[model samples]
Target chain A: MIATETALALQAPQLMTTPPLLTMTGVSRRYGDVVALQDVSAMVYPGEVLGIVGESGSGKSTLLRMMNLEDTPDTGDYRLALPDLPGNLFDLDRFARRMLCATRIGIVYQNPHVGLLMQHTSSGNVAERLLIAGERSFAALRGRAREALDASEFPLERMDARPIELSGGMQQRVQLAKAIALEPVLLLLDEPTTGLDVSVQALVLDTLKRLQRDRAITMVIVSHDLGVIRTMADRVMVMRRGRVVEQGLADQIFQDPQHDYTQQLVHAKL
Target chain B: MTLASLTKPWEAMSYGFLDASAKRELRRKMLKAIAVPGCQMPYASREVPMARGWGTGGLQVTLTLLKPSSVVKVIDQGADDSVNAASIRSFLSKVSGATETWDTTEATILQSRHRIPEERLRADQVLVLQVPNPEPLRPVEPNMSVARQMHADADYGRLWLILYEQIVRSGRVMQGAAYPSLVNGRHVMTPSPIPRWDVPKLHMAQHLTFLSAGREKRLYAVPPFTRVEPLVFSDVPYQVEDHAALTCHRSGVSGYFMNEIPQDDGSSAFEVSDSHLGIKTIRQAEGAAIRIGPTWYENGKMPQ
Candidate 1:
């Protein structure tokens, strides 16, 4: 597990000592004529869960997907300075680009259903990444996968259990285990806890927190739930119409009134 | 049904494209592999422009199995890059003009090396594993007759012995990759060299998982709904590894397996354990453009 706080503190002279793992500058994305994000700029700093919040059509998902490599921007540049590495992510080729995406970054969709293939078992979901990474040695795959399952607090019996057999929370835990097992540097969570019940959400959040502190992974969580953000995020980026309306520390965003849109968002939640 | 009827001619002799004989052999072996889950067979490996050991198994399957319109993904060590992966991708684009993708969901045929894709492979996806060695009995006994006999009788007695020893000494499974498993709770098989982390992902996968060993003469499969159990002991139980520190600075993911590339400073640089191509999806995300600030960086080199 990477120690998120420590990784957040590492100083790279080339990066100008920015804590950000990914920095977007004047980023704009258009799908033919549809502008998804316009001049959106933000830095996803280390140990900080930048909560991209907004209602539907706010471009929150689009913005999050952009950081994932599934979607490419039409204009502007995205620099991903790996926490400890010298080179940025953009320096890779199409093949190299995809390899990094699967192993280095972990993404959780708003719908847990989207994140996992329902046909596979809980263990299968957790172990998929390991297999893809070319650890074809069966002993190695099973041992590490089982370890991840234990770390995620999943039941041993569920290793062979299919996704459909598990509860929503259990499936989420399996997804978390899958992501964690890969040891990704960035975690892109699209409404990670949205569909989950309160108790299950708490469990999942707690697991993420433990994993984060242990691993030191940088996180960019996109959710409308402020509470989830408050609990996990160090900083927040509030998205409105594919633009950042407000950005600051989590505590400050909750207490201080910087932007009316942010204030209203906080108020409505409260 | 006749050979002449099935042996069709090609208008364009595309490189890396399997001829009729190769395709039939591959298809026949694939069916055999599927019938006998977790078995490995040697297919006629093609000389792709890419070097060997990248994704020969995947590329072979792709060339033989692909339709004209099939959308394929060639991932080496789980990522789509790496010299071998890129070459395979290039080869497919030339011969079949098939669409290639890094995303697991979009791919119809996925040729993967050690690691599986991070995303869940669906029923629509057919995963072809590149096997260095296909024989599950290779590690145990050298005699083909004995190994085949053992397999026929579902004899995994040696597996238990191996697990028991681990318990006695390490008190845990110290193994990392290429873990062996029982397909359908009967046939002892290898899940290829993919990390243990990916082993569980194969448990009843929606897609058909095919294993092809080019160097070795073997092919195998784990049919949908077929049980693939990792070899483990009941007393010590099975343990999976977690990134005590799960984080990738570039991708901002915690709780994923990472490869530690040790720098000169003695500090380890964290890369995703899977090949780098898998991370391309994240790097190419909508907001990712904000990171580089208008520089088009491709394949680790800046366009001049």
Candidate 2:
């Protein structure tokens, strides 16, 4: 077997005591008048879900996008080591870089409705990445997309329906279908369950957890909702003013925040 | 009249080929293509005096689907002014009552034969192709029923054998005509007669593809983000036949896909070509080359 293909075969989630799926060291991103993220260093470990919690303008989204290479940092380095892939994201030019994102790293945006292709049917959205990955047989695409939708605990009949026709929760499920279809190594959720009701959010979160368990998908979820962070994250980082104010194991951060800002933010949630 | 005059006609509607009802039927098929993602559907046929070979499939789709507010761009064999291309452009303008432009970046709908626009089409735009044959298996097996059954079963053994044959014959897959493609992972459809060089543009293309075959009366859509791959072996690999031997006539673009123009010397010659944008992009590429960032890689880096 070729070294690359063998490397892919050998790749397994070394989650229990692995280094990290992603690492941002001294990363800084600056716009003309505002600094989005400043010297922000963090590690998204394998197997565990890491939550970056902060308020509206707290740079959580910026940090998440930076990890996805959606927004490249103005200074410092960001490294993403996908299993069996040569080089990091920055090594590829524009075309190959995008192909990498479609193949390895999948991002689900906050607005469930907008993230999916509205015009395409639920099945279309779910099977998009597989097609991009060059799975060209219709039967294969349909069977795989159907299986994915089934695995998500979403209805099979609704697969033919458009996003607009489906409920908010189903839309999130479709988004999940798209993200998980490729079985990406690093899954980035930018508040995926934001618009759903509490019950629906629970279902969505449960589905995500199940998927993460089934595939050793390392996830980094960005959100301001403490409840979501507490439920999903194994490790938590609280940010304020473009910096990590407090970070620790979720239980530890929830019980005892080191920074005053973290305390104030947590207390306000209470 | 030859198809060359179908350029930039304003407020012209095709005399009577696509009546209101026929257009509506075509529109419905287009919507189904978008809805089903990769499924091919039948479309109402429109008669174009220019005949089938010269982009009538592309022109018909453009005419039936074009909105009055749309800006249409047309290209043939990747050149804007190729006789066949000019013909389609004029036909679209005269029939659809839409405006036509040579600027691919500005066009809302692009009618193309044998080439994707050199520029990446926008998400809002639609790309219509004139398909000689839509089925990738048509060449291997003449029977559509057998081919459809093979597609239905996802049976690509025959297609794989053909690719393997190419590898056996040549060191690489040297077959470059209307390259076979896997669309949305459900169908292995042809991107009409576009060269294999233009095949990569169809993969994860931001714009949608509305392909029609006037002869077969079929229409299909490859939605944006739908995966489109040309069948190739991992070792041999599929490759685009870029113009390593020629340069753009207007802007001196070297090694892009080119169209042959016969010279006074009685030998076939090539000029820089992009069907969607015409020769104008050659000039733009020339100007941009001077300011190109060092990080911007060119066609030379394409894997051989």
The lDDT per prediction is: 0.71, 0.73
DockQ of 2: 0.01
Tell me each candidate's TM-score.
Answer: 0.47, 0.49
Please give the range of 10 consecutive residues that has the lowest summed lDDT in model 1 chain B. B293-302
Report the lDDT tens digits of candidate 2 across residue range B1-304.
7666866565344443577777788888889988876567877677777876666666667877676788988877666777877777776776657887877777898887777766667788889988887777765567889777666666564565455434434546666777878887777777777777677777887888888888888888889988988876554546667566566565566656777888898987666556433345544565753222121115533321
Model 2 — TM-score against the truth? 0.49
Residue B66 CA displacement from its true place in model 1, Å: 0.8
Residue A162 in candidate 1, Cα distance off native in Å = 42
RMSD of each: 24.7, 21.2
Best by lDDT: 2
lDDT by residue for model 1 (A78-135), tens: 6777644355444555656666777888887766677775755566566557755645
Q: Give the Å shift of residue A188 in candidate 2.
A: 1.0
The list of candidate 1 runs beyond 4 A from truth reads: A1-270, B1-16, B41-54, B274-304
